[model samples]
Target: MSRRRQLHMFDNTTESELHEQTFTDAVPTSQRYLHRRGETYYFKRKIPTDVPHAFGSKGETHWQSLKTNSLQEALRRLPAEIEAFDSKVRKARESRRQGKVPVASRPRTEGTTKYLQEAHIPSIIERFEYSLLQTDMEERRVMEDDAELDIRLADFEQGLKLKKRAAAREEFSHVEDVAQVLLEDERLIAPPGSAARTLLLRELMRADIQTLQKQCDALRGNLFALPPTVPVAPRDLPTMQTAFEAWRQSQDKDRTIDAYGRYVRQFESENRELPMASISLETANKFRDYLHGCDLDRESIINCVGGLATLWDFYERKSNRITSNPFREVQYDGLPRRESSVDRRRFEVSELAILFNSPVYLGQHKLKGQVKESAYWAPLLGPFVGARIEEIAQLRIADILRINGVWCIRIENLEHDQRTKNMGSHRLVPMHKEVIQCGFLSYVAKQKLAGQTHVFPSQRNTNKYRLWSNALTKWFGSYMNRIGLEDPRLVYHSFRFTFKRQCTVCGISDEVRDALTGHWLSRNSSNVYTSDADRQYPFPAVARGIKKLRYDELDLRHLHVADPFDQVDRAWKY
Candidate 1:
């Protein structure tokens, strides 16, 4: 009752209670169907029992709780609820009216049933008897026609069964039962010489035939009731190969096009060139399964399916060749998570010793008498510079030069015989001191002196992709095997791992390493800032970062090879 006590009580009041009090202070009570309980508003309306059956659970009142305590909130909610209720009531009434058949639409049936029983059945029976007695040839012809109709009816019934049309099945079975009952009537089951028996049998048989005819007609109507199909023209739709070519024409990456071509070719080789219309989701899955069966690695399988999906997506939107991308929904069994890190291991000093001490590394192998060509130098260069196998093998003499007083291997796709993986792959990787000490620049100078265009002329481009070092990749595999390095993953490319590992050990910034290796470094903010031309690190600074890397713990000074040009000269008389 005291002022302080009243203020204390007001302080304890909830927001909703305060809101409700403010609303009710203006109006004591709400309109019909709107009521307050606690601090919230509610809408209540009774559904009359006399309403149409579609309304469902009539005579029960419908209630909706308007969550807000404010009067304005309740007012905002009321109109929408009222409109919905009105719509339900209108729909229920409309549905009730639809249930009743219009008198005008009903056919005149006063004499039709009676006429069918008395006259129509007799006429059909007479015709059937006359036709049966005509000839053996005529009987056979009629039987064949009946068999054909029965086959069509069976197909329709089976389709309905597959659709799970239980009501239709029950209705059809009821008609059959009625036909059977008519056939089993006492007049139709009499002994021979009874004219009544013959008449009943013929009449019932005619009725059964008519029943079957009506059922067939109804089923046929239902079967063909689908919306009219747009006729597809015989527009010389492209095969899978042709479609692939069309898609490839739009792609900008030459390597991507070549890789896509491999997948498409392999698909065609196995499945034959499928017309775009015939290439479906099922076929895509089948190809995936086939790839799995062929024992292709997980990455290969993913690439195959992804390539197909990409092509299908291209055609699905750009041209009217395909209805949909069949491979869109295909789930790729992603690369094995644990296998990723384990796939390549950084070369241990011991492993590096084994690799560099091999006959090929010593320049004693068959290729160009180990002219420090791809075979001799690629392995040595990959570990020092972290270049890809192909990149090292396909290097032209022009690619090796001094940048700001430091020798650099300039990676780029400047000729048909050379290609970098991507734009980021074009970079300048400075020569490591160990490589320079081992006479790499000396090898380059010698190749240049001999007027060689490519630094490694022994590695040739025999493929359509202009992958000059593809054969070198296989040779490296064989050499690795010969050296007793049994791991499937520790091929020539593992040298990249060794180089990157040494870089990390030397505390090289990732941006510097990425720049040297031609890896996309945009994901790193520092790399992005560093790459900006105005504030970019100078070429000499980058060269210093490259020079900072060293592997002195394991000595590779024993890998000195004899001149490779001399070996090539002795191999043939040319």
Candidate 2:
């Protein structure tokens, strides 16, 4: 028999009409899984027959109000509801296959004493405070349109003042879901109808009333606000390692993250991984003592303590449980703060003369390292342009280009492998005339012709820290030691001090000096307001200051080469 003849009731309907009717009866694309009842939209889905119903025996359908009347808003909130429904179905099927009842079906007396702890009270209060804040913000958004809200809020406050249980119960009803979420987050089974659950609900209601009272007082034009009480850490407090991972994720620089991670690892190893809450001020002081006993320098100990402080601060902000950092203002007995100039002193004119006249600078040294180009140029660039060792080490050939008729080196984090110290560090520094005279431009041209991406192509960053200057920094330190310039303070960074001192001696303005050194300008400074174009093509004052930067005592005439590529290729050979 033909299919049309075999069909029962719609046999008389044409095939085209049947197809059209099928399409018409289907839900609209925009309203999928949505049902409109009165003015609000509800998320509705039919439970599959294969999956046992978890939402009681009411029907084989799941329904949840989207709590919005507007179609677009309902649609926006539909995805989460759909996922919740699917999760319920999956849980029901799993429970059925296991021949076990769901947790909701368990007796109320089954909950343990763990759920009844007084420590959870503060967490409950914190949750209520957050919810109250959200409600206040939402009410403020609609207060202008609804003129009666303030009066109603005042009335609610009065009801609470009268110790009305019904009003508190009504407020508690709205936060039942929030309470449930808190229980799940704490991994506590506060069985329904249990004393533990009752206590939680009672505290939640009390917290709501307290928050509402504060809101009512604010509406009365009281500007003074008390600081919130710090919440107690829960039984399952996060460890220092946990806090360190979280803080590490928040950091943007790889070098900083690696350095901080090392400090945290050392702390955990020494202290045996104590919980964050357990580490008191005394503990911090002891850790400081431990670091001192490790024979670490005063500066290194301070840095380690600072790293701990940063991690503690991050956890406090994130969890809102810890109020004060134990590591803050830690004292180091018998250790005074080192003087800046004394810590990393600028090189003397005689030291500069010795350094420039060294075998490495004169191309007569037999140093066995691949970072020859970096070792050669980094020190020169540091003293002349005030570029950091890492900055000069990571420079690309493309970074060397003339802008607005001035030779400029662009320090930026635009490339995939490049990184600046910070946002202010990304700038254009005019090439010092002395740097150009020292075969810098000629070397850059040679590298470009050789199709090299980085200026120091031989210097490969193989370390986990991804520091391009790691090899060169080590080599420079050793070289300094070998050349009889072995003062502990006189390292690579001393070149920056040397540069700044020269600028000061030559009467360079603070603005121009900071600009050349990539230092952040003050917010009130006119340089902060300068346009991007002006920044890229620095003003004549900057170029003039670059030109004025002169090392008159140290003669680099013999060090200057007509062609740097024609010199010995020992540094280039890996």
Candidate 3:
């Protein structure tokens, strides 16, 4: 028996497992519902038992050949095929319930009329023109005479005249088959004899007549005869998937692309994947409202809208056809006003005291996979240096160095796959005296002596994004939750806010604080256009600001270790 026949013979359990393996293991997740037979792929799905008769299928499953062997091409064509299948199933179910024929039908709405007139008819005319061009090219390749072309043009004219006459007499029998083929090709299921079908048939007949007239005029030696003027072709409005792929290619950072791509995918899921041109201002507003209704925070909604706006702007600039971005100037009510300072919730001094007195800082906690030296030192460094978690987690032993006779930790994207948030993030931050006194230097020395490349070599950077801090961030969240610090805004990032608050309290200059934290200088600030040498804060001056960062209420005397190598060595063995 054939492999396809054998597949049908398998029991439910085995069939499901095989289906999972075939789709999941052999292809990417986005390409599900695809089944490969020999070399060509087919879109296959099991027909619901209730709707099997509606689909007119004898077997338990139904499938259609994708008609392409190239995986990339198949992927490109898959979305439309999937949409058509879904539309078919939906219409079939509706018809079965109504006890009507299994044909697609919809109440003629204003939006449907607008789409048919502005998008669908123009698309049909363009396709007809392309097919005509293809036939002409084939005839020219065979050296066919103009007499044959003239005869074909005459036949088209006669067909158009007959169609017009039949339509005038309310007899659309001649055009029904042609209209049905066009409707099916566009995946619009107008019932066999419904008024909607009749309207579509009459419109197609009109387009056909106009096109035939143009052809006859061209054949009569008017080589510059203008084709029928329909609305702009729907082909000009690219699919959402196509636009995203183009936009994604223009991006520089993988993380930015991935972050923004997520919002795009979410938008596509919430709103149907529509062509860029079809996304009107109303559509944009509805999408924003939908996101708001989903209980997403205002900031998250802003990001989603902002990301799509950026993408829309990119596509507008690239295409030069999209007149305006729908997502532009979309408003969200009840959004909080922006704050100048870091907006994250800061850890209270008492909370800091509790965290420092925890078992990990007291050296009583057991070392596991994620709860390693990084976890212990990273939190300690956060308040002192104010570096991002990923920046600190990805640190190397070589990053610890003496600059201008002051011990400084360099945060840079120089080696070992280190990545800073941006160019401004690359800077020299003097090690705080508190960090030094807490045996941070001793830990670095031990890592160097042990010939380890990364300070937190035990923390795995195994995520797809290769972020060393992913696992550590999750563990920190759980740790905070366990320690009774269960506020939504109180996160690992809160350390950065606390550090900034301390900088203000310590009377640190804006330039020094910005330099240390790797924040961008304000465009209107005097230091924005300063020379590189003038902008670079001396390590001693930075160290002074760093030393001023003191928590009078929080003491960490117990965390100071005279020798950490032995303790770290013992922990490493675990």
Candidate 4:
């Protein structure tokens, strides 16, 4: 709570034997300090409770922790902290006595400061610039010695001539050759110094007549002495694969990357070991066949071809070397339309009784949390909710919102993240009260997943949906076959069908149910607005769809599926 006094730390015996109790400052100064342990520098601070932050301000963000959960441990560590401070004080004093200054406190670089103050200035047109020193220029010129320097100096002087006022592009009239062009030529004429350069040029022309031979000698020495550096031209044609690679780097999405990677693979057999540019339309068509042969649907085939065509267009834009888009006008069929169907399967009055008493969905597993909730109720909800496997398997504990007075289950996925799927895909379906009673909250709490983690998890998350389709198909199929039923066609998608058909039977309006399950609103009926869009609907109708029906019976004489209490004598005798 109080600042420690500064000690003139010296005499190692007295320092080590004295109290080494370090106290943190209420306000820390940024100046560096050496700590006693390993001579390490550390930032030390103490925050008061009155300071504003979410956590009580006494909770320090600087020190890792006081380490002791108890006050005794805290007092135990304070001395070591003090010892560290004393060591730092001793080191600072020793450094100053040795006549050493920290590198940070050393003098400013004199030559570098002056060089940076002016990099470019005006020369005849008076533009003086900091010449770029080639990183290896000095080493390269080392072998030449003074003779080479003479040759370079002569060339530089010859290149510095003020040409006779003949260049119509008068901005470039001085400086016989363009060396480094910084500013564009368009703005140089109206410059205030241009008039000065013009007057200087006219005088130089008159003087050049007087020393003609020296000018000629200088020009000859430069021209005959040095081999001119020929400007290298870029490669003529952009090879197909090279252009595609440049196209790939330009893509900024995962889908585009996958699309391009597939297109590159499509070139197998043409250049199996290497990607090459397509020469003609026939090559592109042949590649299209290869994609089809791999059993790619029409939409996927179009994706690969369309990706290539776009890549070629990008190539044409970047370099004039490419002439045409090889995949342009290439036609292929698109994906087939999907027909939506409904699952009408549910517990009938008699079948419902059988399910409640059925060995498959009940027994010790049904004794309420005797095992994992999934071991028992996955069958019931698996049949009733009609949800997709991952949607159910990866459900987070928090997605069930207890909003207002109602509990609703929200479903979402990567498709929802990108906003690509239809509105129906992301929704909150009000769960039936039977489920609320059947251990939903208890399961979430048991798994310790109420906040941010998945309600159902595995040792690894990749397996979340792996058992979905095939498992659901077999689970529901065997149930139908196990009982005396003709239907084995039911799968997880049938769950959606079951809910909708049930919603219809309950006489609930189509709009609310569709939104619950994320089905499309009837665009036609939406235009003809109904009272359903009014302030609100009566709650009783909704309760029928979501609450479990209670039987008016006693002594477990009449439990129900649709009727949960059909008494079967010695139900588990089998």
Give me the candidate number with maximum lDDT. Answer: 2
lDDT (C-alpha, whole model) for all candidates = 0.61, 0.70, 0.69, 0.43
lDDT of 1 by residue, 498-569 (tens): 888889898888878777776634434465444332233356767878878988777877754454233222
Ranking according to TM-score, highest score first: 3, 2, 1, 4
Comparing 2 and 3 on TM-score, the stronger one: 3
Question: How would you encode candidate 4's per-residue C-alpha lDDT over 31-74 as one tens digit per residue?
Answer: 22212222222324443222212122325443324343332343
After superposition on all CA atoms, what RMSD does each candidate show versus the true structure? 26.8, 23.0, 14.9, 24.4
lDDT of 3 at 307: 81
What digit string (tens of lDDT, one per residue) describes model 2 on residues 305-387? 98889888898788777467889969877665656666578899899888888988877886556676877788878788787
Number of backbone-clashing residue pairs for each candidate, in the order shown: 2, 0, 1, 18
lDDT of 4 at 457: 42
Misplaced by over 4 Å in model 1 are 1-235, 250-262, 265-290, 293-296, 316-326, 333-338, 341-344, 360-372, 463-466, 521-541, 559-574
Evaluation by TM-score, superior candidate among 1 and 2: 2
Candidate 4 wrongly placed segments (more than 4 Å): 1-358, 364-372, 382-386, 412-424, 437-454, 457-490, 500-511, 519-574
Q: How high is each candidate's TM-score?
A: 0.50, 0.55, 0.65, 0.36
What tens digits encode model 3's per-residue C-alpha lDDT throughout 274-325? 6665678898898787665544556667777888888877776787764677
Model 3 ranges with Cα > 4 A deviation: 1-121, 133-176, 186-206, 224-237, 248-261, 315-322, 334-344, 521-544, 561-574
